[model samples]
Target: MNLMYLTFQEDAPLYLGVKNKIEGQISAFEKLGYQVTCSMWQDNRFCFFGADSFQRPLDPAKRLMKQMTSIANEYIGGHPFDVLYLRLDRVSSDMIQICKTARANHVKTIAVEIPNYPYLADYMRNVKYAKTLGTKVKTAAKVAVTAADDRLSGRKLKQYVDAVVLYGNKADSFFGVKAMNGDNGINIDRIEPIPHCADTSKDIAILGVAGTLWWQGYDRILQGMSTYKKSRSDGPALKFVLVGGDKTEMPEFRALVEKLGLSEDVTFCGFKKGKELSDIYKTVDVGASSLGCYRRGLTRCSSLKAREYCAAALPFLYAYDDAKLKEDTPFALRLPNDESPVNMDRVVEFVQHCRKDPSIAKEEREFAEKNYDWKTIMKQVLEFAGASMK
Candidate 1:
């Protein structure tokens, strides 16, 4: 089988998660016995990779909309694949035409993955933070158009799109199409577990690694650290080692850290990768997964970081309804799903509880092997996606 995977994600260095995810998923598809091709838009050009990797620049003189239509007509109309997969960003006219062309070219199965469902609220939140009057006005206008386009496109997409690959699916169907329920699945081979020998007698460290900042909910962690500092002067000293989160919001977070007098307790390790990230992981007692997903209008999420934490055989804290992990799960400490600050006392206790169990790392590694691996998750997705289409 041959698969054409499509996404609008960029090849930017800052947010490597999306790039890494696409690469992992493509590998999983190959493992499932499909030859994969990745189609992406980056650096003002349309690029293709995997089976036959290439890049073609778009004409700068023409609007992107016009260029997208031409590209769809020229490429999708000429080439056909057994399956077409999309990491849908938005439901724009260009995307509609792309789907229509792919279907016309006799693509056997077409599935679009909506990573975040009901994402309009996230855009509205962005509108709130717009810096100037003119910027806010432009942003508000764009949001209005996008909302209308999405509503219209959702219905139109059903004609070409056979199924939706959804994460944290709230309904059996989305926009009048059946949903293949799914979550963020990791490539376990790529994520090696941290080989750490826990030392509970010394100070504790917590790690948060993410490219995007606002939604990760590090503020709650900072607040917890602040309260931890003030209330328990004798409490075991805590350190938060953060990687990435260099977006526009970093300055505000820095100010908050200073305002709360948590300079000594927190260390900002901005934008780390490869060995640098691995070295940081070895020092931390526990990992912090998405703590403020509620900010994105999500009560539950299959967070990628949560899976990464498990793959690393690391105990962690999270504040959302996970696809896996129960409230009683020993390796994980679940927090309330809201805007409240995390209680540092609870965090400290969770660390101690994890240290007491020698089998925690083994248990976590087992969990990742069984539940979070890409091959297992992708097989389930393929069962519903490709087979169901036939």
Candidate 2:
């Protein structure tokens, strides 16, 4: 089967997690004898004009519309695809037309790869429910605009798409039941567990990868570490090594570390990849996933970094509620979604426990291999795509 994968960003060097996921999917599809082609937006611009045109100021929205028009026309004119897969963070108006056009042009299957639903209104409600005073004020206006845009896109998607492919349980919680209702007329599909990499580190260490920090809860991590440190002056020595960050972001994060008095405990690995990353993973006993919500109130996330840690045979911790990872997946540790400092303390203890029990580490690696293998995941995706054809 000929398949097309579409996403906004394809830069793997900067966005390691997304790159790995896209490549993994492609690899899996190839193994199943499916031909896959990927198209990505560069510099957040879908279509670029000549250098002269680029030098002058241009309206971004207009440019996007023109690009969308061109892409739509091309697909309409190009070879017929068995499946058209969209890796979308949120639904948009232009996407609705694109999807409609694809189906109109005899595209057999149209599926969306959704990590989680960014329900801006629901998020605003969550913030209010949590009584996070300043947060509500800071995000109110942006939330209003995003919620309006996404809801419209989401509704259109429900009307047009054959299947909504959920990366994790969080997406299911947001849309699964609705999809099943006859009134909704939407199919909800889950991504089969993909295989994880093996642990190659020799020492016990905690690993962290810094991406866009705002929603990642880096500050919470430092606060938790500070709380943990205060609890035990002579606790087991554990290293928290962070990898990835640009020049500007590094200084901001460093300031937070110093402010929390965790200078000695936290080590910034700057940016490393390939062998250096592999070596770092080898030393890590636990992969420190997200500490809190990407959005202040929402607990749903399909974290690619968490998968990477699991692949590395390191037990991972995430402090998000309603993540839907199976209980039998003992490699994953879920912390309470609260502001309590105890969560950090628990993480500290958990890290030490995993260090002491080789069996636990072994279990994590085994689980990753058995569950997250991309080859198996691709088979499931193909099956789902075939179902969509029916």
Candidate 3:
């Protein structure tokens, strides 16, 4: 089967999620003995035009449709495809017509990739809930606006596609279709988890945090570490490493660490990528995954980082409350609730155990290789796509 993959919005060179996912799937399908061709929009003038500037409402939609239609008409006029896979946020009515035309010609399957869903009003409600739970609502309205925009964009794209390749089970249920999951399949086969490189020399117990600092449970980790340090002064010095830093938001976190007298202990490593990141992971004894419960319904969605953590064989502490995940994932130390802080004693005890029993780390790594590896996950994706394995 000839598969044509389309990604119009995420046209970046390095950090484009949609492009990377599609590329991963394409490579997997090829290995499974299927023909795949990716048709992506590369805007040479995007940098010149400014990313946000070009993302303005109707004007860009019209321009994009015209460009997409012209290309689709010229390239696909005579050629026929079995599957037309689209990773579009929002498409013009004209673009829908083009897809319909393709479906009429030879495209038997049309799958749209749904990466995320945002419920703006629900998020606002969540902000209020967070406030009730004694958290600040600094950017509630802004978060709501962004969430609403994504929801509307996703709905608009769904109207034109035949089926959706959902990134999560929650999205699959939301779309009310037989959705294929892609989270497991869309990474480079041998790509190690966060803090990529292994550094065995560091004696200090390294705890790596990769995601947003202000996110749920992150402060918990910091608080727990502070408590642990205060309780046990004689133990080995534990270094708390923060990766993937948004410099603008670092001040509040730094202040919190200072207030707790953890300045000497906590080190913000800024952003490290490729082998450097892998090495950081190796250096760290333990990696902290998300510890927040799904405040929004979106938590039902599996985290890409969680999968990466599992892949890297890093024993993680997740705050996921889904029953599906609880069923049989041995790679994570799942927390019970989002708001309830993790027990500092338990964390300290676990760390001590890990230090004493190196076999615990070995077991976690083995679990990752068996279950969370991209090769294992993508095999399921290809089978769902009807690509035959050789």
Best prediction by TM-score: 1
> Candidate 1: minimum summed lDDT over ten consecutive residues — where?
381-390
lDDT of 2 at 37: 69
Whichever of 1 and 3 has more lDDT, that candidate is 1
Candidate 2 local distance difference test against the native? 0.60
Candidate 3 per-residue lDDT, tens place, 1-390, comes to: 676665555355333333445566677656655576666555532210211122222235466645655555545445676767666543345455666667667676666665544334344665664544335355575565556555554455444456655553344433344566555433535665443223333345445544345454566777777877777766556667877644655788788889988888787777666677677777666667666545544564556566556667666667754432564454456665466655656654455555565565566656556655455565665456454356
Root mean square deviation (Cα) for candidate 1: 2.1
Alpha-carbon lDDT, every model: 0.81, 0.60, 0.56
Q: Give the TM-score of candidate 2.
A: 0.75
Models ranked on lDDT: 1, 2, 3
What lDDT tens digits, residue by residue, belong to model 2 across residues 250-293? 78888988888888888888767667777777655677677657
- lDDT score for residue 277 of model 3: 69
RMSD values, in order shown: 2.1, 7.3, 6.9
Cα lDDT tens digits for candidate 1, 115-232: 8876778788868989999999999998998889888877788888877877753657778888866778788877778875566667889899888778889889999888888888
The local lDDT score (0 to 100) that residue 121 gets in candidate 3 is 39
Candidate 3: residue 38 Cα off by (Å): 4.0
Better model by lDDT: candidate 1 vs candidate 2: 1
